[model samples]
Target: MRPKIENITDLRGEISRLRVQRLEQEVELTKVTARLKARLHFPVLVYTKISDFFIELFGDDPEDLNKKKENKDWVTNILRVGLPLALNRFLFPRSGFLMKSVVAMVSQKAAKNVNKDSITGIIDKVTDWIKSSKEKSRKEPRMADYGIPPDSETY
Candidate 1:
């Protein structure tokens, strides 16, 4: 942020100061940028698109099952409270204090992503998968049993 210019003398002084400052800042920036570029030279950055962040942070898909319709009921309230507790207790019960704190913090953030609809959607997907698997098994026989007759060499 440059200071407001006033008189000619002040302006000239500011210009000289800024010129010196700019060169120093530019050198510093180049050094910092080089270090940053070296540290972040992984191809992960190249693979990621700007839309990925938007999609992850906020569901860009209209038909997203996780949050098609958010109902702010007792379930939602309970989820907000229970999710962090459950995650901390079940997943990271043996973790240290710092790990538990981090889990608690992460779960607290994640709780906002989940709701009644999301749970229902997960349940529905599981049930649908089970049904499809069962149906698939029932519909098709194995290669040996599909139409092949048994060998009778012993007989």
Candidate 2:
């Protein structure tokens, strides 16, 4: 009987030890799964530096309005725009320079067209209209004119 009881106690201890190990394995698996899920959801970001050598050679001086005006010619445009685009595509086939250049040009044109004074005038008009509407509402008693008591409440 004593030997049988000792064997049963040893089995129970082994079962408890196995349970602890299983729990530890489950925790590790969860951490690994979370890492894998994160990797799948968010790809790694890669940034490539564009060499300034070509820009320095072919690009126009940004501060020189005269050079910018001169670049409007077809020949200059081909040199400034066409060559860089072609070279970029040849060197880096997957580079997004075309889209970036188009967006930059469009935004620069839009910025040039925006009038600060016009925007300020519109804002002033809106504020004045709001103030006038509030004043008119306070000055006129619509409910009283309609024969409703000022203090009465209805829903």
Q: Over the stretch 1-155, how does candidate 1's per-residue lDDT look in tens digits? A: 77888899999999899899999999999999998888787655754665477567775685563453454556666766887789878988888999977876677666666667888999999999999998887955547655546664455
Tens digits of per-residue lDDT for model 2 on 14-55? 788779989999999999999997886644322112324434
TM-score against truth, every candidate: 0.37, 0.27
Model 2: runs farther than 4 Å from truth? 1-95, 140-155
Q: Which residue segments of model 1 deviate by more than 4 Å?
A: 1-71, 94-98, 139-155
